[model samples]
Target: MIELVRPHAALVEAWNEAHREWGPGLHEDGFGIGAEDDVDTIEGIQAWIARTQQESGELWWIVEDGEVLGGIALRSADDERVHRFGHIGYGIRPSARGRGVATWALGEVLRHARSSGINPVLAFCAETNAGSIATLEHHGAELEAVEQRGDTRVRRYAISY
Candidate 1:
């Protein structure tokens, strides 16, 4: 089953365990973890998540089957530069790939955004991430632009109600 949940600092342990990957993509084509140079410890992820919730009212959900298989963040309230271009982000634990979990969770977030008065939501992913790109389009997100974050590339998609 899927859910939209708020993660606490305590869940940092789970986030750390769940995020154990070379990166956060379902496909093995060319997906790599973002911000490789940055700290990826549970403490760091917790701090980042805390700030995201405090500043943007974003929430986290565990996409799991009794385990934290993957997670998604509802970032409607995020209007910072990163969010201004792409207000939402999500990832599936490598073990849970190709199961339609991402599609369901993203759809739920979009519905959450609409009901919560967050118009014109943004969803960004790597340009080469066809699975993520397909998921966004499947849920009605339009490709607004493709951008490069230094050497890394990103595709920005938007859905407006």
Candidate 2:
């Protein structure tokens, strides 16, 4: 099962280790495109998590059963660039990839989004990220736009709550 949580120091530690060793994993398509920027340290991840959680009603969660298989962040604290729109970002450890953790955590995020009254969350995944694209589509997200970021192609999708 997946649990939504506040970003804690321990989770940050795990994410730091995992991201450092194998950030891209199978999600290489998102490496420098429509996904999270590469984070290399525990302190950096902690700060990012704290800022997002404190400033934007974002929840940082560990997809685990006593072990952190992956990490996910759900954000609702929109800015001038995001107030009416929300974005979700997540990743699984290299050791835990292909276990459906991301898919399930996203399902949890969708339920949380509905409860939080943040309907129609807009998410961006790299066009080459077939796994993520398929996962989002399976969860009922509809492709809304395809755009370019630097040399990468990104596909935007929305899921109405």
Best by lDDT: 1
Reference-based lDDT, residue 71, model 2: 57
> Residues 47-70, candidate 1, lDDT per residue (tens digit)?
656555565535565635446556
For model 1, the stretches where C-alpha displacement exceeds 4 angstroms are 9-13, 22-52, 82-85
Using all chains and alpha carbons, the TM-scores for the candidates as numbered come to: 0.74, 0.75
Please give the range of 10 consecutive residues that has the lowest summed lDDT in model 1.
28-37
Model 2, span 1-161: residue lDDT tens: 55655556766655455555664444522111123533455555555555555555455555455455665656664544343223676666667767677788788777777888877887778799887887788899999888888898988888885
Clashes per candidate, residues 3 or more apart or on different chains: 1, 0
Q: Can you give the lDDT of residue 13 in candidate 1? A: 61
Please list the C-alpha lDDT of all candidates, in the order they appear: 0.65, 0.63
